[model samples]
Target: MAELNGSPVSLEDLQTLALTNYGHFTSMRVDDGVIRGLSLHMERLVRDSRLVFGAELDPEKVLGYVRQAVAHQSGSFNIRITVFDPALEMGHPGVEAHPQVLVTSRPTGAMPPPPLKAKTFSFSRDLAVVKHMGLFGQLHLRRKAQLAGYDDAIFVESDGRVSEGGTWNLGFVDEAGTVVWPDAPVLPGVTMQLLQQAHEQTTTAPVTLADLPRMRAAFATNTSIGVRSISKIDAVEFDSDDPVLDTLRKAYAGLPDERL
Candidate 1:
C-alpha cells in the first residue's frame, strides 16, 4: 500500500480512493489490456468530484496523468491519482473543500479465489460518493458481519432482496443452472454489468437469502479478481468442487485478450 496524492490507501484496496479530497485519479489493468470500464468509471468519478467541490470537471487531464502513472508500472497496473483538499482539514465536515491531487500505481494482489470477483465496499460516509476518508462506514459493515459470525455482509434492499456485498455484486446459481444478479438501485459495478450482459453465461434477477436453497453455487464479479466463486453464505457452505466456477473464471480471464 502507498499514499496516492497523500491519501492513505492499500495497493490491494479498490482503486477508488483517487476520488477523495485528493483531486482526481484513474485505475487500469495492464496484464490483460483491460481498462475496467474506463469511460463509464471516469464519468462517475468526474460527476462525483463536481458534486463534491461545485467545480467544473475535466477527467481527460486526470486520465492523462493516470496513463503516465501506468507507464511507471511493470505488469498489470492498478493506478490512482488523488487530490487532497488544501483548504480544509480532515474530520471537519461542511468546510469548504480545496483538494490536492496525488497519483500512484501498483500491482494487484492474488485475487480472492472463486465467486468473489467483485468490488468490495465497506459501509462508509463515502458510500453515496467516492471520497477518500470514511473509516466509520468502512469498518462498521465489516465488523457487523464478524459479529454476526459471517465471513461478510451482503447489503440487502429494505424489501429483503439481496443487493450487493460491501464491495461486490451478488450472484447465485439457481438450481436450474441460471446465474442471477441484481440490475439496479446499486452502483453499477464494472464486471457485474459486463458479465450480466453476456446472457449465455449470466442473467439478472432480484436475489434474496430466502432463495438460497435454490442456489447450487454462487459467485461475484468485480474489476479486481474478474470473478470469484463463493462457497459459503451466511454460515452455509457449498461445493468447492463445482466446475462452473472454473469455467467462469477462465471465461473472464480470457477477456483481456478478447477485448484487444
Candidate 2:
C-alpha cells in the first residue's frame, strides 16, 4: 500500500485508515457501521494471520489494537487487516518488522455501481480456502482497466473462465436472459454469500469474455455497492440499465446511518 502514490500508510494502523484506502479488504454494505463485513472480515484476518505467520493470532487482540489506536474516533469506513512478512514478502532487508500486523480503514465514497458487482483479483488472490496477503496483481489490473475507461475488471484464470471483479462478484444477463456467474472459489465475501443465497436470479458457472456480447446486462455484487451495474468494459458498453439492477439496489443499498 506504501507504493500507492501519496497514500498515507502506517504499519499496523487499522485504526487510523479507512477500509477504502486499503485493497484486499472486507467492507459491510448490507448492514450498518464501518467495515461492512466486520465479523466475517475479522474471522478471515485471524485465519489468514495464522496461515502466514504460523501465529495463532486472536481476532480480539487485533480488535483491541484497532480500538486502542483509533479509540478517540468513530466513523464507518472500509477495513484492511494485513498479517505477513513485510520484509520477506517485499524482499526488503534489515526491516525489523518482518511478520507484522496492520489494519487500516478509509472513508467510502459515493455508491455508484448497484445490483451488479465486481471483485478485483487483489481481494481474492489467495487460495479460495485461505485469505492471505497476496493478490498484488489485482491492484495493478484495476488501475489499468480504469485507464482504459472501465470502472472494474473481472478475473479470468488460465482456463479463460470468469471469476469475480475488483471486490465484487460478477453477474450478468445472457442472450437468453439467463443470469450467471462463471466461477465460485471466491473468498468468503459476506455480500456475495448473502445475495447468492437470497436471490433466485443468481447462478454459478464458467463464463468467458467470449460470452460478453451475448450479455444483455452486467452488474457486480458486493457489500459496498450492493448490486451495481456496469456501464462499460474495454470501452464496449454493456447494459447496466436493467430494472433488476435497481430492484436489487433497493433491496440492499444505503449506509449504516440510514438504517438506524
Candidate 3:
C-alpha cells in the first residue's frame, strides 16, 4: 500500500500529481527492519529535492515518514519515497513549494531473476540526472522491449553510446575482467554507487552498443535487483557465470545494512 506523508493516498493526491507530475523519488529494499545504504537514499532525496524543486528536503522528516509508513511491515519490502508539492500548478511559476513525501511499500522476493535478456533502444530520459516522476519515454521503450520477448531495455543515445538501462544502471565487464560503468549521464543509482565503493576494480568508461560485442559480460544494478547478470543484448550473448559478476554479487552482499 501507499501513503502520502502519514495518510493513505487519496484521489485528490492523484489528481494533484497528474496536473504537474513534477517530483523526484528514490526506492530501496528494507530487510528485517534494516536497509542497505539508508543514508545514501536520504541524501539522494535531499540532493534531488534541491535540484528539481529549488528547495531543501528535510532528511529527518523524510525518515520519520518512511518509518511511520512501514511501521507495521515486516520481512523484506520494496519501499519507494516520492517528493512533490501539492500546490504545484501545471505552468505557474510563482507557486509556493510545500513538498509532500509519499511512501509506498510492498513485499518482495528474496532475489532477482538469475539473468536478463535486453535489447537496445535509441532513447534516453529528458533529465538524466534526477530520478523524477517523468518516465514516459523510458517506460515506452521498456514496454516495446518486453513485447519483443526481451526482459528489459537498454537505453542508448543516437550515437549508440549506452547511457543506462530502462530502470537500472548498466555495468560491463571488460575483456580484462574489470567492471566498467558507462560514463554517460545516468541516474546514478544508489546500488551502483555502493557497488563502486565496495569493489576497487570498478571504473567508469564510455560503453556503447557497438562495444557490446567485444565486452566479456554485462550486468544490471538497481535497488530492487542488487546485481543481475545480463545474458544477451540484441544479438550479442553474455555469460551469466562470469567471475567478474560473481565478485560483484559478493561485493553487494557484503555491504553493511542500516536500521530504518
Candidate 4:
C-alpha cells in the first residue's frame, strides 16, 4: 500500500523522489495495530524533515496519517514513512520547502533471520547520521558482497574502523560478554536505542576489522529483524547461538509496544 497525505500516491509525484532522491524515511514493524518505538520513529521524521527540507513536521499530524494508512491492515507488516517535497525541483532546491508524507507498507519477513555472513567493504555514507534516501553506495557494496558469495556487507572506514551494516546497526559481544556498539558515525537506529536502554551490560568503543577476532559474538539490529546474529565478518567467525545474543533479543522483545 502507498499513501501520500492520507490519499493514494500518484506516479507523477513519485517521479520527484525517483529522480531527485532528496528525502528521508523511517521504517518500522507494526503488529496488531501497535508498534514498538513509535515515538522514536516520529522523532526521527521530525528531526530529519527539519534537517533535509528546512521545514517543520508535526509528529501528531504524521501519527494521524499513519493511523489512517494502517487502519485496514491486519497482523504483522512493515511500514515505511518517507518525507519528501514533490513540488521542489532539482534546479531550485534552495527554494522554500513544503514536505509531504508518503506512507508505504509491505509484508514482514520471517522473524529471527538466519545468521548472516558479511564481507567487509571500505565505504561510508554521506551524512551517515541521518537515515536519508542516499543508499546507492551501500546497496552497491551489498551487491558486490552478494556476488562474492557473502550474505551481506559491513562498511568499514578508510582508517580501518568498522562502521555498520548495509541497512542495520552492528553490535558485538566482548570476551567478558559486554555489548559493545561501534563508536562510528552511523544512523542511531530505533531498535538499537531500545536494546541499549534495556540491556544492562553495554558500552561504546571504537571497533576495527582487526578487533573482530577478539570479540566472541556479533549481531545486527534493525526494526524489521529486531536482533539477529552475525555468524561471520570477513574471515572472522562468531558464535551465532551465543547466550548473550539470546539475552539481547529477549530484552528487545520485552520492550512495551505503543498503539498507533
- TM-score for each prediction? 0.71, 0.67, 0.96, 0.99
Candidate 4 has its poorest 10 consecutive residues by lDDT at 248-257
Model 3 misplaced stretches (Cα beyond 4 Å)? none
TM-score of 1: 0.71
The residue-by-residue lDDT of candidate 3 on 18-74, one tens digit each, is 878889999999888888889999999999988887889899988988889888888
- Cα deviation at 80, candidate 4, in Å, is 0.2
Error of 1 at 19 (Å): 15
Candidate 2 residue runs with Cα over 4 Å from true position: 1-35, 85-100, 113-131, 175-179, 253-260
Question: In candidate 1, what residue range of length 10 has the lowest lDDT sum?
Answer: 116-125
Off by over 4 Å in 1: 1-28, 32-34, 81-84, 88-100, 112-135, 144-150, 199-201, 240-243, 256-260
lDDT for 16 in candidate 3 is 68
lDDT of 4 by residue, 157-243 (tens): 988889899999999999999999999988999999999899999999999988999999999999999899999998899999999
- For 14-131, candidate 2 gives per-residue lDDT tens digits of 3322321221233443223344445666776667655544456566766665554444445544444555443342333233433445555555545763432233332335565554
Report the number of the highest-TM-score candidate. 4
Every candidate's lDDT: 0.57, 0.55, 0.88, 0.93
> Residue 107 deviation, candidate 1, in Å?
3.6
Measured over all alpha carbons after superposition, the RMSD of each candidate to the real structure, in angstroms, is 5.8, 6.7, 1.3, 0.7
Which number leads on lDDT?
Answer: 4
Question: Model 2: what TM-score?
Answer: 0.67
Tens digits of per-residue lDDT for model 1, 165-232:
66556677777767777653565666666666544766777766677667888776667666677777
Of 1 and 3, the candidate ranking higher by lDDT: 3
